[model samples]
Target chain A: MTDLPRPSAPPVSAPTPGGSNLDVLKHQFQQIWQVLAALALIYMVFFVLSEPFRSFDTLLSIFGQAAILAILACGTTVVLISGGLDLSVGSIFAVVGVIVGIVLAEYRLPVPVAVLIGLAAGALMGALNGTIQVLTKVPAFIVTLGGLTAYKGIAEILASGRDLSRFPENFQVLGSGYLVPMGIMFGVALLTGLFLTKTRLGNHAFAIGGNEEVARLSGVNVRKSRIYYYMIGGVLAATAAILEVSKLNFAMPARGQSYELFAIAAVVIGGTSLFGGRGGVGKTLIGMLIMQTIIVGLSYLGVGTSVQRIAIGIIIILAVYWDVWRRPAR
Target chain B: MTQADTATPLLRARGITKHYGAVVALDAVDLDLHAGEVLGVVGDNGAGKSTLIKALTGAISKTAGTVEMDGKDIQITTPTEAKAAGIETVYQDLALVNELSITKNMYLGREIVRDTLFGHLFGTLDFAKMDTEIRALFQKLDIRITDIYREAEAFSGGQRQAVALAKTVMFGKRIAILDEPTAALGVRESKMAMDLVRSLKDHGLSVIMITHNMQHVMNYCDRVMVLRLGRLAAVRDVADVDGDTLVGLITGAAEDKVA
Candidate 1:
């Protein structure tokens, strides 16, 4: 039987007059120009106000400190874009750190094995969060909010109220230098960006967030895809936790406390929508850098920690306001 | 255009029923969609119009029914299964992600990836290929948009409708189901949308459209099916029925003459 030809593969014709190379560049710049301008303006303000902030070393250290948050925020960016939240990420980080500490300090496992186990634990916790939310049809906010407290308790129980320290020399090297954590941050960011833009699941995340019922009608497995997003968030949280523990050579149950909020703040500051379906890891990187710059710069100017917190709080509000204000009325 | 095909319909649904507890939404509704023809489904509010379409397209499960394609029984309990059975639905909401580019929304669930190791392992989308093909499709369909890379939110309601229609044309094989394709558009936009609906037949695909617009039914549909109070009321060639008769059939003022 001769079947009708499917238009699945249309003949490739000449490129359209619009969307030229320059147009593409212009469009790309349009998406990021506002955030980029904000970052530059903030940096310049800091550079001019504080003499110490003008130095290259201070800038390197600011990025070095921002690296951990950047890694954690990458996962947050994915989760937010998928229209879900994982408030337990901070606890997930602490739990993974404690797991790594136990595996190395108490169990005498190899670094690679312990690292794998920690990562797995992180994924497992994330899976638990995602699975519980899916099965119960509970809002992710309530589920992860409960997990925020519960997972922290679990981590504390695992640590027995003591901080684990003094890791092997090679393990300490993983986070000791500026390059290693920064490299991991960029690598995770690159991977996260690719996952969002390149892969089918990544695209589904955006669709699901933008309008879940529509995504479902379009044959997207909303439940399954959401779980995968939470898993990515979980694994990245673990990555950040391990790096922090290695750098500090200590793992306390209190580690990564309130880091989830910081990650979210950074993601929002980077122009990612808290409501989801609109943001990228690249914007998130800039957001993280902007945040770190403000914190570090304020300290250089002899501003107290309380004042620094106020500054971050104000920035977060402004960022979200800017997002809402600029958005065309639907 | 009103001449019925005596040959087998491309898609047929029998005894499609749905119940919400004591409420009977659709009751034993039957439909036949012939090849290369537009079938308009019309009903008043709560007259089982959307429910019948939902049952046929597997958006909602039927209480009792069977759907057939090409004279063969097919099981479709979900939208994915419906699409797999050569049925695509353009939902009332259009289902376009506001933040994504037109090309991205066009290939949301079924994205084309690079045929490389990266594609195999990581499922990296080949945007260049997608861009090229979508442009070709728009050109072929005579739909013009300056940039396919613009987000869906940036487009007007009519443009988004066009994108949704284009998507159905792209992936829909034998049958395309549209749920209120122009319910949201202005007068001019609605005309454009109906024009696209008419064009769906030119592409050699059968269409089942759900609409309340009498003008659309008169202009676009080859045949019209009326649903009233959870049951199939009448099926008429658009050539035979006036707009008043369709409204009467929907409101139960006039009995189904053919029945």
Candidate 2:
């Protein structure tokens, strides 16, 4: 770029005050291609490792299993972009499952009514987390850490340490039916993408995450925006729980344990920044698929569950490392 | 009628004072921002220039003051109210989010939306409209960008300042307050930024620029206000004084030249 505007240079000449258009295209492609390439590599390896993985049924089943985690990761993407974490999602997930199971089995409510109650319960838990974080001026990490333990305790008490199971066959459609959970995941993802890109609240979340002080000066209600993202995180956790419980035909107090870690791993692998601001649910979906593929691929290769976990842990670390290393030139 | 009654100032402040516990940041500062004029605020460190800007922008509360717009008293308790009241500030920090695209940063707090079938179900951004609007705005300012979709971090310091000015023009139609618009630029880039500031005036927007650059004040500002030790030392039309006189007033070494 020329330091000084030449006397002869047309006032609004050709390209950028920064770099050439080609340079921008190259930078843009680098971010998109890295994840695409990784996904392709994972698929290539898995295709060779197992014949069943190539089957259409297995592909659908993989997505079906990924549905719950992918939905949870969508919420995580929102929170992370808004510069917060939701460690309480797993505990919230467990509690939602327990609440839904009780409403359906004990209260004998209709599935729709029970589902709404469960979602509301999840929203309440999220509101609690957000309210405390905002009002008390506490960090989200600390607030949600407390929530992780406290919510699990609530789930345990609700279930009285006994697993709840055996819902109506109609209720099973939500979980056992491949289309429903997958449909929910896709619907949630689509909505999330729009929210992040189009809405004023979505823009506020990015502003808050990017620089809270700046956002405040720009007339963004930073505190309210933060609370909203947390609420969304809560509601999504509940949705994931509802699906998981329906699929298993059981709701245990311990269900969704360490599920927070899995969701976070998917978000990071999808290249969302842990430091907050700068990512989307689209990349997060890719991240979720990559995570699931690894787990499934390892199992097909006869690897033990423990080894598969170790592999996942390593990938998460590497993914984060690569993100930090490969963050576009500031 | 008083001499000042012939034409009402666009905005007026009287007896504005602010104290931070023990320290008095601003002391009975009175000023007028007239329509279609550049008012340059010059001061040394802690001269209460920033404090005064914060007060005017409603970023903070004043200990005692009255602000009048069109002869009507108004209370601006927050930045949002300040914005709604047609006041915009381009802070020294520029206040751009590095992670967001130029378009996103431009419309950070205020986003435009359109109703679509899915939008009725879940709201969507009217990105096409925003893109066209921003592109036209940049073209008007003579700022070239390879891609508006590029993040703010990808731009140079000069380019970012241009983008910030575009945002100010978009939001602050009545008045623009720039806190050091040319502080860190090279000579040519400073010229570019100054030209953008000049364009704001040409478009008939009132400007209040705070800077240490005497040349900039002399060249760009229509009137200059000097603050010293939390007090208004001098306010003069740029045509009446030289750069040295302005500096002397800022340092409290020269007698009040204007009065």
Candidate 3:
């Protein structure tokens, strides 16, 4: 074997001018090709299924359905890049909705005040998660697992097992209106993209995810950065909660149950590795679109809810498996 | 050379000792570094080379030691503090985020942020400036990276070493501690790294390089420090000593002869 001539080597030659630039473009295309293919496939399926699925109203409905999940996924993407998971995001979303409903219905507060309170409560919840993880040095999976159940219980207690409904019409517009939730999602996506690519904190998050010891050696405030990442996740989940409550014109204690599953699924499907250190907000948006399209497409095709759930489950596994497969084998 | 340059050392470590419970890793090691000089540290396995570097760089807490710079005592209790004191270390592992671009890794902690309202509130990184700085630094070091945006994972071993060295050169102000900087490189890369060491000296920076390769010591270092069994065995100028003599000192044969 040692004496054998190599057979896999390419012919030695000078690369053409602009070859490096072409290689860069090809590398980038390779990264997004799968997601792009998935998008095309979903669009084709919808187009073939019904003429109405291609209508503007149906597209808007899809965006509206995806808006909340998109916001949640944006935050989750940041946390995932920092090499952590937040199972509590779904719980936090439910709890934030409950908090907002309490402020608006029980306390009869102004909408902005209630919204602010909800956002703050969500951030505080996230901060608690971050603090506990850092102080205890426990794995985030365990910490957020505890939070997932505990926060749900808290939300149940807070909402008193009633669906809080009858919001003011202006508040209702924030969710059910044609453009508002979509606008919010677009804004969140843009900001998240900028944060990950053009900010120190964002770079630090990826650096920590890449190698925590190396990040520490580089003088990154690892604990503080993790706390901030969780806080961002928390706030975004709250924002999604607000939109969700408004869209339905009601807040239920069980709202957003298993929403973390959807958010994580979107993130993984977006090509972001669950192991961290890769992926971006743009990819996550594509993941969100793919997910919403699948759901809406299923309903339009008259697939039962159970079948839709099964489909989503299979897709999540396939997406993650493909991600792992695409990576260089260690 | 100035009078003060000859009179006072750039950095001095006096009675630096580290103990891990019942195990003594380093025993009262003392060393001095002068401006514009390369100091090589050599020892056998478990000879406390890495331990000494860690203590100096504040990667671990030393049991007892006092490190001085410019005749003033400095405390390096953490990596951040070591950085604040203008001391940088290129560990054998390189401490680079393999997923990040070279510019990002170079400015990982000390990122350049503009002071606009958006930047101040949101902490936006000035990537253009960082890219320019990286390009300038690479030019200065004669390291051609076709794409500055490429991640460290894409770099070859020697190229990675060069990137790490460039990172150190970018932020290191006082002294650099390189732990076997060229130990993992091939012939060309080793020569590149050795040339970097020599360049650091030319730029009036002090360097402490730890390696088992005696050839590097003989060819690049101004003085060589030998450690045997966690103790300082000998220190000699490269002019006064050869590779065989350094190996003997390292293995305790020369120590027996001296005694």
Candidate 4:
């Protein structure tokens, strides 16, 4: 603060919404802290409110799988931040799981190679979505919607109506059996968090979603950035697939079914602006935790999954509404 | 290459033209801008005013034209090139990522990389350097942004524009072209924007402003260029043309004798 650069010229005033104003940028740490505080308060309220109705330990336990949600949310957040959506994430997750299982079980590939293949497959699929959409100027909705169907088909083909299980002991490590998966999940989250907050790529991702035209004008290599975003998203979904396979120890085509929705929900709950130009992977992590806790706790109480689905729907809607309310009018 | 006039016109466009399919959007326009001058461009809708500026800034490519900076003809085929040539454009919408802090937006494309030895997952991001530089730039602009790192979406409209202007200047441009910088602004805000425009001249950069408000042309401009029907009507000294005469030129009531 003391080494502030002196004004070379007289100060130019900021333009106000209603008048010529110098739109003040208040402290960011303060704003983020408030958001984090609100998030904590909401969680406390959610726990306290739900306590009379359920067990808290169950919620914590189910949250372990919320890592899947967190991963998907990470992908979804990238798409959303880039001013688009990726309904294909769920399908991509499914496809990647099936492919990994096939390459490892039938083709007898090395575990490390399988991981690479699965991740690469996911990235390629995502790149396809981005390329076709940007190249054709098609709305991402349509493009990804097509991807949703196409990828699901690929998953079905790979699984061939049989859940591909009986993998190497190492593969078993990812599921509920070992702590490595948990560690990896946290590691992935940390990496993602750093990618979104610390890297130049992450900064560009946020910038593109905030104002794409402005991003392009600023020389952000918009097309390349979009492609990069989707690639990151693809890798996350595939990684989530590996984690899911480890937990379930099954490469069922349907294993990752509906995963994209969960990820989107987590991202929204984490406080990412659906409108783009706002959000971070860290927020998505919070969102995933919230979801995992809800699913686990509610299930332990034997609340039907239908009810959980309804709860998820409500959570998504309310989360978006909250975001809508807090957001400044564009 | 048209040699840059030693007097150093901040920007010069010779025989600039752009055509879209069968239509001619901009046709053979020549513009000269001098350093430390606020050149006002007034034109009716579809008069190619925006097109000309867009061509200069590389927001759009001209079908034909030579752009000169500092006495040499150069190709400005992209926004990056235009910026590198010391030309900047800030659109009316302000074109800022409101989710970004002023400092972040100011250095959106050009980020200072930090040493990675201590840098974490995203790389060695030097938030400290960014924060310090951003705060300094904001202070210099008298921008009252309290935090240099908050998202831009939280700011008001005028504040967004300020961020945009700061972005252009921070990038180090010699010519700044603003499109309808004050269109949606209130009287006070518009006056403040004009003040910034005037300040650009003091900073030794030429300014080209596109505005619908004739009052601004009369008040803030050193010279006014009026356009009609996709062509130049007249380039008049501010001292000579009244608001009425300028409007007449815009509406084609008067013709430019030079053309």
Whose DockQ is greatest here?
2
Q: Write the per-residue lDDT of candidate 1 for residues A221-281, one digit (tens) a residue.
A: 9999999999999999999999999999999888899999999999999999888888999
lDDT of 4 by residue, B1-259 (tens): 2222346575778888889998988888888898778889989999999898988888888888887777787888888888778777886564666677666777777777786655544454677787777667766767666544545555545556666776666665688899987766656657766777776776777789999998889888888888776677778888877887787788877554332
| True-structure RMSD, every candidate | 5.5, 4.3, 4.1, 6.1
DockQ, model 2, C-alpha based: 0.42
> Model 4: DockQ against the native?
0.35
Interface RMSD of each: 11.3, 7.0, 7.3, 11.2
For residues A1-330, could you state the per-residue lDDT of candidate 2 as single tens digits?
112222433233346643445765686677667787899899899999898788887778778889999998899899999999999999999999999999888888999998999989988998889889999988989999999999999999999955488998899988786789999999999989878877878877777787787888888888888888988999999999999999999998799999899999999999888888778898898899898888888888899999998999999999899878866533
Worst 10 residues of 1 chain A by lDDT: A2-11
- The local distance difference test score of each candidate is 0.87, 0.85, 0.85, 0.75
Please compute the TM-score of chain B alone for each predicted structure, in the order given.
0.94, 0.93, 0.94, 0.88
What does TM-score give for chain A of every model? 0.93, 0.90, 0.90, 0.85
Segments in model 1 whose C-alpha atoms lie over 4 Å from true places? A1-17, A161-163, B1-6, B255-259
TM-score for predicted model 1 compared with the true structure: 0.93
Candidate 3 Cα outliers beyond 4 Å, as residue runs: A1-30, A49-52, A161-163, B1-6, B255-259
Candidate DockQ scores, in order: 0.32, 0.42, 0.33, 0.35
Candidate 3, CAPRI quality class derived from DockQ: acceptable
- TM-score: which is higher, 1 or 4? 1
Query: Candidate 1 falls in which docking quality class?
Result: acceptable
